[model samples]
Target: MKQLKFNIDSKIKQLFQYEETKNIFDTYLPGMRSRLESQKGVSSFSLRKVISYSGGAISESAIEKIDQALQNVIVYVDDTEITEYTKQQPLTTASAEMKAEGMYTSIRPGKVWRDTEGKRIQTHGGALYYEDGIYYWYGENKDRTDGNCTVWTWGIRVYRSKDLYNWEDLGLMIEPILDNPNSGLYPEKHVDRPHILKCEKTGKYVCWIKQSGEEACFLILEAECFTGPYQIVKENYRPFDWEVGDFDLIKTEDKKAYLFMDVNHNGIYGFELSDDYQKAEKEISRQYENLHPPFCREAVALFERNKKKYMLTSGMTGYIPNKSDAAYSDSWTEPFQSIGNPHPEDESHSSFNSQISQVFQVPGKKDLYIAIADRWVPDYPIDKRRADLIMRSVASHYEPEKYPMTEEEKREIMDRPMLEDVNTSKADYVWLPLRFEDEKVYIDWSDEWRIEDYE
Candidate 1:
């Protein structure tokens, strides 16, 4: 507990690199930690420089207090003391051990969901695929430092679960082509909303992820088993062209597979897949046509219950919550009836402060469907910017008038560096049960609930 090593001259990012000091900064430094994450070149700037840019918001005395606490801080332990959660690392068949360690027993909405690896489960905008009595949960892996691209994800990460309460990380099923930028799986390209389906006819696992960046399209890959070394069947594949955004895939009881995709800002277009489930046969259904930006919808999650089809969607707001709508139809190809906001009780009608990812029926639980959602940018709430149609949230800009920077100097910060935060591991998940009464759907929020509580 001697005096701190690094002084005020040290780069701010240097302290954040260590978990011990990072916690200290978060506790003592107020808004500095979040500012460093998004604001360009702020992290690399010296501690003193950052405080100056804060325009008297972050005082000098606060820095001295943080430095003193860092001296007496524990070496290894972080502020988030989940020592028991890490007791058994990388567990596969250790459900009993996990429970004994006081880990997962219920689904806690809008909270950090840790995997068996004792790390935050990085499955944002993901889907659940059931096969051989095991459920495979997969989605985008955003575990990287700010890099070259604006909206970047490493690739799709897959995990396995038996009880649906606990997940064991199986690592990346579809790894990106690091050496080749033109490859569909490249790190710069965003491959999100991964919806996987098991083709009973071929007995192969098919994964469909929408890759949007330079060339927006769906990349279809196939593997013999659930944990795949997936072979790309088609890359940059668009069933019919407008442009692709978020998507979902499902195999029906009639032995048919359909892809529910958002065609840019137009509408949610449904495409029926071929027999092998490799390519799109034809466009089947189009729901929720948009007249303008605010009306445009993305994040389309399609599911069927009680012989009827349900489509869940959200507005154009990027990484922020907005009003969610539901549509229903008798047939997959037919037009769906507007059900209005399913979460009417929520004052903002922002889908309980989340965006829908998928809706799947729980095994053996009749009429029970779980709406998997992502509470992206949980720090922010629904506002006028909700319909700005931004694809990503930029870091909070430094205060201008308070800071003593000239207008020319202020403009320079915008060009310092475009920070693309790839570490979306902090993003929380909101999975809630769907309440059905008569053909209409409803989602009621619960802080904590379990599968056993259903039915």
Candidate 2:
């Protein structure tokens, strides 16, 4: 690499404010930051990029500052303009680079869904959207330059790609405010697992997330753009004002929105969102207590399969993966039946020792569904905190059945260690596939064994 000769010093302040512009300032700041910490004695620096679709004096002053800063370093708007005086290289914007990968390398093989261009982008508890032949993934980026993990200071990270596989980090979609009341300065107000739903009426993006601290009020927020400077739409407790848990939203054919959340005793509850997408309709409250072990189940995924609706729930053990359960109902609310765990022998309670994140559907297929989870790496600090998002497919006609364990299996279950242990006598983990009498959709684990056979 050629080191550009410039009279500039590299020890200048880093830009921390969010500005909507692409200028030389953005390009050289990272390098300036690098040089500041380098063995070289460079002391100050500045750079900028062009701002598209805007014309203002503030923008002009921005350009002037760039010219002055480069009085000592070479600058170029394009590669051909590069000369000894134009020393710094232009900034590179993110573009898709990989194929989409589905969850579970051992299961339902599909295209790759995520990638980290050259940076570690951990947008977990995120959602996916398809627009203009491209997919945009939004979530939290927990990686920080400092080794210190700021207890409640993480920002929403965005990544966009043409095919789900090669992702380019779009930077923070939602950031923590040190002065705002909703800021995660305390442990209770932290943001977790944000899901986005585009409003049909207003053409805006709405996000719902679990807010910890001060009693875990699950909040709903909105922004005009998918990559947002999102404004607070409404901040309230769940319908009953109970501490809301991980939740997901789905749209009915009629465009009506429904939110599925973790209800009392680790069960599942859901209700319709008002026309504004800010408040929940009280009359629509529906709860299901029979989906799996009532112990600490939190994250939920709701969607329609073969014209019928289904939900998947995961046990709450924090970053650790657990045995998860899937259930279905003909109606959006009411009378849901459990489909049991896909893996009954794993210690995490799931097939591959993973935790559920969200469920994704193949764009054109109604019966096709993929369950996503984060297979967290242990003890890598924040590195482990950012787990690899995984997905696996389920059979179209899957159904859960009552378990009848053999005597030997029963004995082994009695000798299990922890309550979350797969071998525990709680046969809830020992699920069997169901054979539905009707022609409705069914998802069976044993017969669905081919989930791991996909290439």
Best by lDDT: 1
Candidate 2 has a TM-score of 0.57
Error of 1 at 26 (Å): 35
Candidate 1 lDDT over residue span 1-455, tens digit each = 22335656666666776787777777877666875776654665667766765668766688778667765654444423312221322423235423332458899898777787666677778888777799888888765422322336667888889988889989888877765657787765677788888888899988888877548888889999777889988888877665788877777888899877778768888888888998878887777786344457888888888789888888765555777889999988777777987887776557777888999788888667999998865655554333222222221232223324445545443333322432354578999999988988899888999898766
Best by TM-score: 1
Please give the CA lDDT of all the candidate structures: 0.72, 0.50
Model 1 — TM-score against the truth?
Answer: 0.70
lDDT of 2 by residue, 1-455 (tens): 32333222221222221121223346633343343334121111222311211223236665556556545454224433222212232222234323333332223221122445443336655667777777787765544311112223256778887644456778778865543444442221457778888889888888887775345666667898888988766665666676677778888888888887776434567778888777678535455554443244577877675666777776654444545676778788655677666444443234354455666664644334555555442221121211111111011012213333344543332222221111111011111222332433233443123322222
RMSD of each: 12.1, 18.9
Model 2 lDDT vs. the true structure? 0.50
Clashing pairs in 1: none
Question: Model 1: which ten-residue window has the lowest total lDDT?
Answer: 387-396
